[model samples]
Target: MKVLVYWAAVVVALALVAAAGGGQVAMAAVRCSPAELSSCASAITTASPPSRLCCRKLREQKPCLCNYLKNPTLGKFVNTPNARKVAAACRTPFPKC
Candidate 1:
C-alpha cells in the first residue's frame, strides 16, 4: 500500500511537469507577421498600450527582435522608448535586442 501511494505521487508529479512543459512549447511555437507589427506600431509610438493581438504578435516575434534591432531602418522603431512602454504595458519583458 505504501509503495502504491508513492508511485501514485510520482506519476502525478510527472504529469504536472509534462503539462507545464507542453504549455511552454505551445507558447514558443507562436508566430507573428509584418502586418501584425505594423498594426501595433502606430499605437505603440504614440505611447498607447498595445492591444491583445498586438502583444501576442510581440511575443511571437521575440526571436526576431535582435535581428530587427540590427537593421538600420528597423532599429529605430524597435529601439524607441515608446516601444519599451508598449512592451511594459503588455507585461511582456522586452528582449535584449
Candidate 2:
C-alpha cells in the first residue's frame, strides 16, 4: 500500500511537470496590443510565419490561450494550425490551448 501510494504521488508530480512544460501555462504570457495585432494579422493570414514582434506578442498572450480556448468563438482563431505554424516559426512551442 505504501509503495503504491508513493508511486501514485510521483506519477501525479511528473504529469504536472509535463503539462506545465508543454506550454499550456507559458502561453499565458503571450498577448498582443491592437497595433501589434494589426501587424501580426497580415503575417498570420498570409501564413508567412510570425516575426519577432509577433513572437513577442505570442509569448505575451501565451497565458490567454487556455481562456481563449474555453470560448467557442475565440477558440477558432486561437486553436488554428496556422497559429501553431507561426509559433513554430517563431521558435515558440505551440501551447495545448
Candidate 1, residues 28-55: lDDT per residue as tens digits?
Answer: 5643223336546555545666888888
Report the lDDT tens digits of candidate 2 across residue range 1-97: 5645553554454345335543234333443222233334545556875677888877666565566566554456557777678878877776764
Off by over 4 Å in 1: 1-33
Residue 86's lDDT within candidate 2 is 82
In model 2, which regions exceed 4 Å deviation?
A: 1-36
* Highest-scoring model, lDDT: 1
RMSD of each: 18.0, 16.4
TM-score between model 2 and native: 0.56
Output the number of the TM-score-best candidate: 1
Least well predicted 10-residue stretch by lDDT in candidate 2: 30-39
C-alpha RMSD (angstroms) for model 1 = 18.0
lDDT of candidate model 1 versus the reference: 0.60
